[model samples]
Target: MATQDTSTSTQLSPEALEGALAPLTAALGDRLLTPPADGFAETAAVFLGGPERIPVAVARVRTTDEVAAVVAVARDANLPLAVRSGGHSFARHGLADGGLVLDMRLMDGIEIDADAGVGHAQGGVLAGTYSTAAGEHGLATGFGDTGTVGITGLALGGGIGYLSRLHGLTADNLLGAEVVLADGRVVQANADENPDLFWALRGGGGNFGVVTRLDLRLRELPVVTGGMVAWPAEPGTLATVLATLAEAPEKLSGMVNVMTAPPLPMLPAEVHGKPIVMALVCFAGPASEAEAVFAPLRALGTVFDGVSEIPYPEMFVAGGPEGGASADARPGFLGEGVWAPDEAWAAAAIEAVSSAQHGLAVVNLRPMGGAIAGVDPAATAFAHRDAAWMVTVQGMALGLDGVPALREWVASTSGTLGVAGRGYVNFMANATPQDVSDAYPEATLARLREVKRAYDPTNLFAANHNVAP
Candidate 1:
């Protein structure tokens, strides 16, 4: 299991902090946010909640050269380094508890070469931020389902979003990347250049280096029929939706979410706490043909239908309870992939959500197929390419007080489904060392370690879903 970051209570050694400060402040100048600075708190705040980390300093880099310079400073000082892009890691792995954190937030730039249909984006960009901007060009790159997730983590770890089936995982669409290695060397990886590192970067977590920017293949996504449709909890209904989505056209991708309805404006007030099953889908084909494609879904006793022909970025629309804050929050996440779903599996899904003892609980069945499976499993570091159903069980509470029960629930539920060992790199929250290793196949793991040794032999960037050298 991952341990706590003690940087919160213990201050950095003044000499070491001072050592890193001079060159960093000189290179970054006013962009550096150190302790006692007015914006330090705001600069360090991550998504969900507090990382509880008070790093010696946070260097907000606006250029790739600056990223290289800050990296050299940390390297020369022998200080551990962390890379912060969007700060949306559920594990908050974006922050190095006590080390210098390179803030990539200011490098948020998106340039779409419409002629080439390629998107070159900075590491600090958010999924939603990029999606919105890409939508303006009637183009987009697949990312995590949420708008706020950082593109760097989401893409590097293997993004499964609304466009997953239509295109493929975010990493599959990546054409190239510019990475800063442990030795302060900046290199570009692509199909023809540094192919080994390029292979590792696609679906391999941020273990090799600090990625400052990425070049991704953009898709022509002018519109999509996407939204949520909910129903009162029923095992049969759940089975039908999962099966239907599995057999649906490649252009249609979605998630089957089972949980108590949150008090959203559209949902009836009385239904706030009632158990329900919701299917959120996006059809990337012609907008006019979406109704026909989703005809059968409406027949499943729909309680709410918000599907519409909205802009591509609208797929990131969100509602429901605000999850617990990052700090003081202990959440257990277990993910598995199944070939099919049955009534029993659906009932178990419902049970998983309702059994949470505290905070919030969610059970999601992300249907995978189409373009996601078209790529050879061995082509990228991601290996779970064939599973039709990816089941994720999540439980969150206020503190460590609720962790034991949450772990027990996840363990029992995952075991019951007979998928106890499967792991999705992106969604495996609060993961252990073994869990990180298990995210890839045996062969892939060996190759990743080899690449790890080559690029980051000492594992200088060890603050993510780490791949040990």
Candidate 2:
């Protein structure tokens, strides 16, 4: 168990607290949390894992008003407040040292308007929940590959998914957001209201304020043709597959993973331990049309081909890994589209990943283009608007003991694939202060700082991708 810091020099006075917290508790009843509550441990455990830190208290807000109240309390107390949606920050950005943690997981609620092609999801809602709810209406929004990621975090960081090529990034479809400023004021931000904050929230991470609700623009989507296609681990075959995919249609988006084949019923027993290029693809079109689009890949002589026509929601299920264990690796986003020569750095990165000593190291390449690139980089805080491929180097270890070696391998391997030295905030696992700085451009960073100053002058919300106020 993580221990909490009890030094009161930085804490609020009892008199100051009485005035700020009395009305909040009166409004919320028993929703607020102190150190010794039964829910404290569970609330603290919400963070994904890795770093250990404990907050002075946990605020279990159930509504926008409750969120505002908690913010007010933290502000009055001069306490560092961490806002947690899904608690999925790779760097443990949702946990504070000894301050207040406003756990927003309880606020999940999804409402879909099929006729209007829009969906309203609360800040705490997970991507899987929103995807499933919208799928019921034959509608969908672009989100990250993972279903457990929070809608707030992914949308804010410019969500990428199967629908990215056809539609756009998740932030591109954001209609509006209800945010609670540091001053405890709730305001709706959109194109017509507080537009600067709206722009900042699109890709600025959690630098502005705590988003209570999000109104997202939805697309008319029914069935999607998608699944995995696994090819043999031979060097020539892997090289050809990647080269072919580079010129593939923008309507089809997929992720190519070069790693050791897992022992599954679908895989041949002979090819289980050998290396393989597992391609997870999703084509946003009719089943018949999608088959034709995937013909080139099918002809690649894959050892196992699992491609099939499935509903859009099923795509989410296919990408989810079976077990839950902590893994260490470094993640970076190449700013210069996918223009690297096949014989140069790209092939070298693949070769290094395939030969890594880590149990199942992989250089996962995600195709990006089309609707995602159509959006202007300056239109939102997400600056990697024109990137053609998002690559992640993942190393999965069995236990925490292997973290050091795995981290070293991932770091050195990522250094070799270097393009711009920048990274996508969502995939960043071991982001340093410089890595965080590199995620945003100078102009965006300056504007974010100003916004942080205006909203959280004292830097109360300093636990996330922090920006100095």
Candidate 3:
């Protein structure tokens, strides 16, 4: 079990806190978790360990009514509010500092309307669960690579993944949402209803309210040719691959990384723990033409080739690690707007991760063009749709002791690459207030604040990537 980091915070009076939680306890029955309560420690767990702010109480709400009740209780008590879907926030928004956290795990449910080409998922739904459920109907919506991330948080911050090039962002696929506002009012936000709130929720992060359910538009995804091809870490190789991918068809989407290879069956054993540049890709349209389209990338180095035809869920197989036991968090940042790489930064990136003495370490490069750029800049709160690349330098730490060194390495590596300014909201890890502000353009931020003021006037949902009202 993860130990508490109570050193950083003052604990609330147990008697007063419990009294404040009485109504919630009565309403939620056994679902409310208080300190020393059964499953209390487990309720506070998040993907990345060592999170600060142990929640004063955790309410695992299953229904929309339960969500409203929890919100009302938190509001009445004037406690900080944390909204958790899949318990996968890199910033640990799932936990709170003497606050009430609404854990949405019990709400995981995915219902697909095939003929309508849409999927309505409860807040607790994870990417893997939703993908498998929707894939069964031969339909999909792009999300983060990992299967465990909550679709609600992922979509709210603008999800980028293997199918991003073809389908745009996860937020772009959002058709509607059931939201419990700060004052305990439940309403639906979409293009035709509460339109301004809908715009802010797309990429504005979870600053307005707790999203209980999401209506995502799904695309027909039958078969996709996807996998990785690696090369020894050669300077300019990643840039070449990115340039090629920038011009590649919309059906193909992937991520580039410089990592020390692991001894997996798909890769040769000799290359483990050595610098390498690898590209993981998915060609969603035609299986026959995937290899041909990937020819230029293979020629870059081609030490290992695992590309093959597979279902969309198979694309997530061995797709890096996050949450649960995979605590060797790879933390970094992507600056605002589109990036046309400087080429020299690729060398800096490869050199940076090569210095890691132990555990998983790498610099990631995710291409962000194709259909992502096709959206109007002001269309959604995810204002960086025009970015060509989202870059980050992440690596494993030797537990908490190595965090200082790991963070320093990441900072130096990113400084060399110059991916500064606003960052991707989902990638907002340990970001400063100014850094968070940079995530949106001026006009986008202004409009988002307007919506924030209107809905979350007192800013009860300030634990997320807060757009303060």
Cα deviation of 313 in candidate 1 (Å)? 1.3
Our tally of clashes for model 1 stands at: 1
Top model by lDDT, which number? 3
Residue lDDT tens for model 3, 218-284: 9988889988888878777867876787778888888888888777677777787788888888889
The best-first sequence of candidates by TM-score reads: 1, 3, 2
lDDT of each: 0.78, 0.75, 0.79
Model 2, 332-394: lDDT tens digits are 565455442364555576577667765567788776777877888788888776676777876
RMSD of each: 2.8, 3.8, 3.4
TM per candidate? 0.93, 0.89, 0.93
Candidate 2 local lDDT, residue 47: 37
User: Of 1 and 3, which scores higher on lDDT?
Assistant: 3
**Rank list by lDDT:** 3, 1, 2
Residue 370 error, candidate 2, Å: 0.8
